[model samples]
Target: MPRSALISALLLASLSLSLNARAETDPWANYDKVLKTLPKDAAATLDRGVSCNHFSGEINGDNSAADKQTFREMKKLKCGTVDQDIASVKNKYKNNKAVVNAIQVYYEN
Candidate 1:
């Protein structure tokens, strides 16, 4: 193979690897990824008394539409679409709910 062709093949392989690693290419994998983000313990409240089926603190409130949109873009890139359905849970009691979905995120000082 020519030197240029070798470089092109390498570049293409690198690109494919990077894309596959960053995005959840599989639908079931995406669902599992989101589910994994759910709080392990019992936490988060549903408005309609609906059980907490979907959950994730990974990109919950720690992200901004403009400031940071990696998570948002990832879903779109992977599934070629986005899921707009979102539920907000407020832990007013500061009880076990707080203990369950405790996020230990840190921001720049």
Candidate 2:
């Protein structure tokens, strides 16, 4: 390859690696950062809600002991409050699109 072509290829390869590294990063880091900006109660409520949903999704009729344990722990999270908290958070952050969207994305996942 010509020298300039080789340089361009190296730059493209470097950019690709950088993008892949970012793609593999822990999404929760960003989520946690966003939650940290909220009031303590709001952040806790949201974290619990997300955690509850995460565990709940793991449950099925053919559950292993660990799955049952997860279910029990999820129950303790009081998922019933999640909907109310979500509504409250949405209303409270209605003016902040980033906050609202982050919460929505966390729940959706």
Candidate 3:
């Protein structure tokens, strides 16, 4: 390959690797960022209520360490068990697209 092409290929490879690494480390980081922007009360409510939905995703298999930590945090918040809170969070996500989208992206990751 030409030198320029080689450089471009290397850059693309690096980006792919970084993205995959990020995906493996914390699938929910993007969503967490979205969650962070909510007002304290809303964030707390939503997190307490919906965090288990994210945890459910983990149980399904994504298995990111960051995701596990997020679940731990949610548990610490004294939210009801994962099943109890999941529906509530899903309702919030349906009502709040921005936050939900962020969380969806995390889940998608």
**lDDT scores in order:** 0.37, 0.79, 0.61
Q: Largest lDDT belongs to which candidate?
A: 2
- The full ranking of all candidates by lDDT, starting with the best, is 2, 3, 1
Could you tell me every candidate's TM-score relative to the true structure? 0.28, 0.68, 0.36
Highest TM-score scorer:
2
Residue 57, model 1, lDDT: 30
Of candidate 3, the 10-residue stretch with the lowest lDDT total is 100-109
Q: What shift in Å separates residue 98 of candidate 1 from its native position after superposition?
A: 17
- Evaluated at residue 24, the lDDT of candidate 2 is 68
Compared with the true structure, the alpha-carbon lDDT of candidate 2 equals: 0.79
Candidate 3 structure quality by residue, lDDT tens digits, 12-88: 99999999998877745555676678655446655555554555555534567876776676578664553344445
lDDT of 1 at 109: 7
Instruction: Look at candidate 3 and tell me the lDDT of residue 27.
Output: 44
Indicate the TM-score of model 2: 0.68
lDDT of 2 by residue, 1-109 (tens): 9999999999999999998888667566588788888777667877888888888778876878988898789778877678788778778878977667767778755
Query: lDDT tens string, model 1, 1-109?
Result: 9999999999999999988976754433443343355454212222111212222233456556642464554443332211211112223324534323332111000
